[model samples]
Target: MAGFFKRIRAGLNTTIGFYLLVVVLFWLKTYLTYRTDFTLGVSGGMQQFLLLVNPIPSALLLFGIALYFRGKLAYWLMLIIDFLQSTWIFANILYYREFSDFLSLGIIKGTGNVQNNLGKSFLEILRPGDFIVYLDIVILILLLLFKVIKIDKRPFKFRYAFSITILSFLLMFAEYSAANANRSGLLTRTFDNNYIVKYLGLNEYAAFNVYQTQKESSTRSKAKAADLKSVQSFIKKNQVSPNVSYFGKEKGKNVFIIHLESFQQFLIDYKVDGKEVTPNINKFYHNQHTIAFDNFYHQVAQGKTSDAEMMLENSLYGLPQGSAMVSYGSSNTFQAAPSLLHQAGGYTSAAFHGDVPTFWNRNNTYKSWGYDYFFSDSYYKNKPNYNVGYGMKDKIFFDQTIPYLQQLPQPFYAKMITLTNHYPYELDKANTDFPATQTGDSTVDPYVQTAHYLDQAFGEFQQYLEKSGLAKNSVVVLYGDHYGISNNHRPAIAKLLGKKSVNKYDLAQFQKVPFMINGSNLDGHIDHIYGGEIDVLPTLLHLLGIKNDNTIQFGHDLLSSENRQIVPFRNGDFVSSQFVKSGNTIYDSSTGKELDLDNRQKKLLDEQQRFVNDSLSNSDKVVYGDLLRFHKLKGYQNVNKKDYDYTKKHALKQLQQSDRKHQTSLVDQNGGKSTVPDFKTNAPELK
Candidate 1:
């Protein structure tokens, strides 16, 4: 035992042994970070093994290059390389702590609002335990200081460096293969960043993110005007006339769009433990003033919530990969809902979200979309215990925004985004009166509780609107942004949903999201119309009595008699009342059985395919080619994003200016007294 200790100490004093020590330390740091810090789905032995091995190649590759250099230069290079890699890992850890998402080049460029708002309090995300990540560096510096392992004097042989590089590359290849086998298409699929970091390492995920951003940038630049022709003709031919009965019924009324985050249609009247999951939303859905769609789905791609916003606001499809709002929003020209309503109805348009303005690049996107005002985290007083994952709790968010919402002029178009029900649904125990499901999956259990909380918040907001006299003359549109739980949680969800089994078809059906519109003048009807987020803007436009005859909208009016109910998903899937075409498999909508389509059915499927393809193609063309810049709608002026700013100071100045410019502001009308009450919630965090 004494001899073994002496040998180990002697070996560790060498340069090669020190390099190996660095690699091992990196691996340990990653494991500790993955296991304790972030929820990277490191469950079974297989996943644990993947996490353990994935960090090997990156550490080796980064440090191995230092072997080629000599003396102090070599030692310094190794330290620098290790530090750079560590920085990347540390950045991801911080970002993932807040977003439950990995950092990317595009996100980095777009998160100015986050940096500016949170920079002063950045220590909030760190913990004393996280200092372990730097312990290895400290040890190395101490060793050099104490002369335990002096810098190597010999020049590193070419063969040694070459061999190390080759070994690192091979290990990396093996890691990719293993991850791909376990999580099919780990390299190619439109997947969540968490999955990538779980199976493949943070370093690899960063590399992939850079590559994807560059590829998207390349595609955007290469887009041509000629590409717009097919999509334009297809859209023109598929236009549906608006329903005369519902047409202009709520014309010039206030539009209040409530964006429900991570909400699904399944929770409308769903009962868990014999208690309603979303009672308030259910009641509102069934109210005589509400028109709810039973078969509506969210067709968001990799962008998730942001994609839904892009489609709902612009009547355009999100990109095939990554967030369109983040990737192309600043550069693209959009004739979106805010601009359209402002131009057509003399309406003041504003969007209220209790999140970082730079989230999804919304600050830039909203400006480009011609929003008169945007109330984001900068405008919100995110007091202690007020905010949670993503942003402020839904109740607090709604309560705080009422003053701003009221300040908008009559016949206004405003969107309020809720945030409590976001993914990996977490709520303080004190707030949760509802019992969790015994699904053994933590994500599946809280899904209902947070949704219930959201429902209560909505009910409170609705009551406030009624009390303020805004409900009578307003069209309140409630929509689910995207699916809360992903396909990874499908099996557990299937058991909770009381299904014997679930497949791709069942997973596709899980994408259904709630869409309800309530107004005093509009008649209530349960419409079984099949549509997606892309159809929202045009449908609202018709209700507001706007003529979209010359506008290039890809979606048809859901209220129209000739409404094209064929909804296209971003991932080459289409769903309607008749059938669901997902990838290569077709399924009967009414029955869950597989379809053996006859000649007529096949021909219809082909036509639907063309329509879906052409629609997506055209929408992409509009975004990629900046087509809207060339074709200005009559009466609509070009939006100058540079003219608008959503900084805290600027936002306040604009609000005050609006108060002065238009005495119609509710704050002025109420003699500077706020109509909103302090927010109250059952959340344990508040207690």
Candidate 2:
């Protein structure tokens, strides 16, 4: 037994063993920071067993230290391990805070999909000072231990160390087994961080628990029946239907809804190299029925692209903080676009994207959204590939969509999302298919080239519409999905545009995208109104002579003659007109101006908070249930579009009263004594 013990000690003292130990410790730190304990409950027996064993790599290092201590070597390796671990922990802490803030404000829910350049930019803004502070703490501890601890007399016995290591390894294995007990079953106890606290230390477990609880609570509250009911009541009592008196005077129009991917308005620049980079878009903006929404902002959550799409199409609430596309897609209960349109106006709806329908679970969501047909990668053949993983070129997507447009029955709604302008925008060198127009050594220049290509494609699609005889009747609306995140090109873009620095908010022009409605029958006029992707649905419905009886829409029609209120969801807050922006000064909406700014700002902020809370907490009830009940009561088939006129007037009157009441109450709640003067209570007469 003595000989065997000695041999084991000798084996562990090898250089390879020391490196392995370090590697194990590094991996454990990563797992602890990134991997939520929630998985322990989801997996069946074998998977749980594996997860429990996942901590073995972390535990082994403590034992390996004694066995492989060549004093100096051990010290350096430990230092390196500590440094890496500290960095990872610090990064995670920042990410967690940002994610939590975003969730609290309803900007995003808490799925950790920060893949875009804008995502990186947001991360950069996330507490850099806090990260530095934590890093300093780690350094201080390391210094104190290295200088003060006397290691010469410290006990380093092989048997004792081995025993502890074995014990830890066994414990980890047991934990893994517990995690894998049942894959499909709701193993809440095992998965919950609060439960894990029974074994893990309080600090580690608490960090995860706080995050999880908030997320779960938020999601449940949003999807709750009571909340949905409130929204429905509010809508039924407020929303006004547009009169169709002018419908026959105006020609039947073509509507083009372009959902741009990660576009931000901050990216729009008038000149580059003394030449306009986006001249066509600028011209369109100047000439068309353009509504320049300056205050419009994107509240991207975990499933960034999908969340934007959902908010725009369905006006449905977002997922719980932690639940994103991967998890949300697994369920079929979420509200959707097509169903609402079909119910409201009998408009034939279709969805189009330039990728696999399965990506982001759009296939499932689109089907649920009530789209009669969906065009995806499967819909096209013999198309030139963009050489990226997602799908074919945007040009192809647009070109192919033309055929489908011609065939779709009249009074149809088509949603087209393009993709060629996606990140890593390099023209393929190997394929001779799409000839390169511009070439440069810098990586970012390719993205510019790609953007140019996308612009050209847009122009081509417009030409196709005109030639195919669809221009006179169709209405085309285009906008970006989110801001592009490629960091390589930011500096170049800034330099080209003559900007000081390029950040997420500054890239708002990219998010600004192009939202224009052009049809031969439509007048060429510009409407500089603040709006967002969420408003698109209501606006379109209104334009099509469709009345929205659903109470869940948080958005109002941009064309409506009401006082425009634009609210952009950012991380855990909102950017509104009330938010004062001056020369580089970002203020909390309330005190954004020099203390003397209108007290109404405070009321605005409070109103926004109430709006978000009410919207989130009662989404399903407000959006679907109340509307459905109302429709059912009146008889869905029996009531024609004319029936909504009285409801519209009544709802509009109630909404105005409610808005005033909310404003007054919110201001009072915020400790402000200011009172809003009551406006005329008379409702607008429908033509």
After the best TM-score superposition of candidate 1, give how far the Cα of residue 225 lies from its true spot, in angstroms: 5.0
Instruction: Give per-model CA RMSD.
Output: 6.4, 17.3
* Model 1 lDDT per residue over 1-687, tens place: 999987877777666877888789878888788887676656667777889888889889989998888877877787788778777777766656544566677657645533333442235556676667777788888888897877767787889988999999999998888888777766664455777888888888888878877766676567666766676677788888888887888998999999999999888889987999888899999999899998899988666778899989888888765677887788888888988888888888889888777778888889889898889887877676787666789887887787777777677888998988875576777567787777787657878888988998898888888777778889999999888776656567688779977876788788799999999987788999899888898899898899788787888889998986899887556897778986557998888789999999899889887777778767876776677776757888878898787776887778777767877766565676677753344444445
Model 1's alpha-carbon lDDT is 0.80
Q: Highest TM-score: which candidate?
A: 1
Q: How far does residue 474 in candidate 2 sit from its true spot (Å)?
A: 1.2
Query: What TM-score does each of the candidates earn?
Result: 0.75, 0.59
Over 510-609, each residue of candidate 2 has an lDDT whose tens digit, in order, gives 3344455554444566555656666766776666665555434766776676624545442223444455332223454343333343568657656655
Single out the weakest 10-residue window by summed lDDT for candidate 1: 113-122
Quantify all predictions' global Cα lDDT against the true fold: 0.80, 0.48
